[model samples]
Target: MRGIQLSFNKTQKLRLDKALEQLEYFSSKLNSNAIVTVSDTIPVNHEDGVLKGHGTMELEGEVVATLCGVVERVNKLVYVRPFRARYKPEIGDIIVGRVIEVAPKRWRLEINFSQDAVLMLSSMNLPDGIQRRRTAVDELNMRTIFEEYDVICAEVRGFQHDGCLHLQARSQKYGKLERGQLLTISPYLVKRQKQHFHHIDQYGIDLILGCNGFIWVGEHVEVKDDMIEDQTNKSEQQNNKLSGLASHQNQEHNYTPLELRQYICRAANAVRVLSTLGFMITVDKIMDAVEMSTSKNLNIHEMLGAEFYVLVAEREAERRSSSSKKR
Candidate 1:
């Protein structure tokens, strides 16, 4: 019942009746039913007896039907049917993501997909009671508002012609996340769900469930408290340690939060052992370049549901820039 047959001419239409005749030569037709499907697009109507492209015909008990039209040609597997479900991100879809890199115009987000999506600076809403075009200063300060490792809620702005998705958070509910652990899941699963982003109101945990197989979660109270404590500690530690070092150590290290996250991801994955632990491990050590390299290796791109290479070209560029400035 399962076999492959080819059509020789592009102008011919492999009608149901003609297909049955060809099939009859291979198998008996007595007490058998047949169904047909065109594996490729045929001329609107061709009278030639020759079959064109590929097609499938099925015969079951007493039922006979043709599932026709253009077919996907990969191997030879043909379906005499259509898939009932398809995956596509829609507007207002709530997704969770990790900041992968920040360029001048936008932030590249690794939404756990083959292509990292983009969130443009224009898509972000101004803080409450402050309305003005985002200036260079605002762009530079962007990281101060949303740093690397910060989880955020956002809406799907739409997809680019090349299939890259764009996200925007213009409302109070869509910006600067306070708490939650991000969970990555398949984009297909997110598309199938009635609600893409789920607020864990019951558990009182904020979460951004990205369609790209990335999710962010944090404990509400702890995130805020820790952020403040971490900032103070970082300043104190930097001052105490740098006092003993040369003034050259005071060079500014500027990067968007997303860029930092990308660096951390790369560094965490570079470690031989941690590379196998997967992408969820957080790398907090800021001073060790070797650790950062190991982490970066683990930040693989999830394209077509498979793990692919991570986007580290930007990280390399940053490193070169930093080195040049130091010299």
Candidate 2:
């Protein structure tokens, strides 16, 4: 399912092949001939009046797939869901993106979509956490909020009239992400859910699963309204010539502890390994992989080893087989 460009030893290769073969065997038994690729004509009843949905196109009165995916039918509607595709934004979906450009009043983000998404200055909460009209001065200082290459977390606010995507960060939880690692994975692997932000208090890490396949693994930061209060207080003190009393406190925590950084790396590597194996990336799945490595007493780097890869594959095969039996 995934094409990894790493070399494997003889035993590791055999084990990996066996695990993959088992997974394929189970998949074949379940889906049979239902799966189809692009240009494939999906068989349907003409008398029933089938409605061709996404990933399908009419080709000479035939329902041909425009994408490489499995055919799905719902009453009179039929569509194909592509296996490997770019992230398609949906309203209310939380996503992680990087600012590529600071425009006139918005920041353009690269969210693994066909077109970059726009995060308007007005849509997000200001640094002071105050709600007011965005003045011309605020627009001029937009870069101070989000400069180029700043990783941001926001919610999809639907498309504009011109088909451009718009993002919003109205809440405290949605804004600039810091002290973490950003990972890219296939959007298909990330299943949509009501909750995307997960704070693992035990490990002291926060995991944000962006619907756009951009994952943020980092240290937890509390959402506070005090930033704007400090700004307000500092200005008043400056006007009264009491600047010493309004000294700016170093509130930003920059250094990540060595242990916490190691845990982040382990979790990130676990995600990478699962994605490389084409496994569904859920919180439990990722945590299980991390725990597996810990139980085996493997170092953080060893999680990416050939032997570990085969082991993970074998575990996935067993998991799938067990799930199939349960079904």
Query: What's the TM-score of each model vs. the native?
Result: 0.40, 0.86
List the candidate 1 regions with Cα displacement exceeding 4 Å. Answer: 1-88, 160-164, 191-194, 200-202, 220-327
Global local distance difference test of model 1: 0.44
Candidate 2 ranges beyond 4 A from true positions: 1-3, 38-48, 57-66, 224-249
Q: How many backbone clashes does candidate 2 have?
A: 1
Q: How close is each model in CA RMSD to the real structure?
A: 20.1, 4.2
* Residue 45, candidate 1: C-alpha displacement in angstroms: 18
Collision count for each candidate, in order = 44, 1
Best by TM-score: 2
Candidate 2 lDDT over residue span 1-327, tens digit each? 455877898888988999999998998888876788889889998899899999998899888988888888899999997777778788999999999999999999999999999999999988665568999999999987899999999999999997889999988899999888999999988989989999888899999999999999999887755565456764663563344324322235346899999889989999999999998888888888988998999999999888788889999899999999998
Question: For this target, which candidate reaches the highest lDDT against the unseen true structure?
Answer: 2
* Per-residue lDDT of model 1, residues 191-249, tens digit only: 33555434433333333445554545443322223243335554565674466244334
Worst 10 residues of 1 by lDDT: 302-311
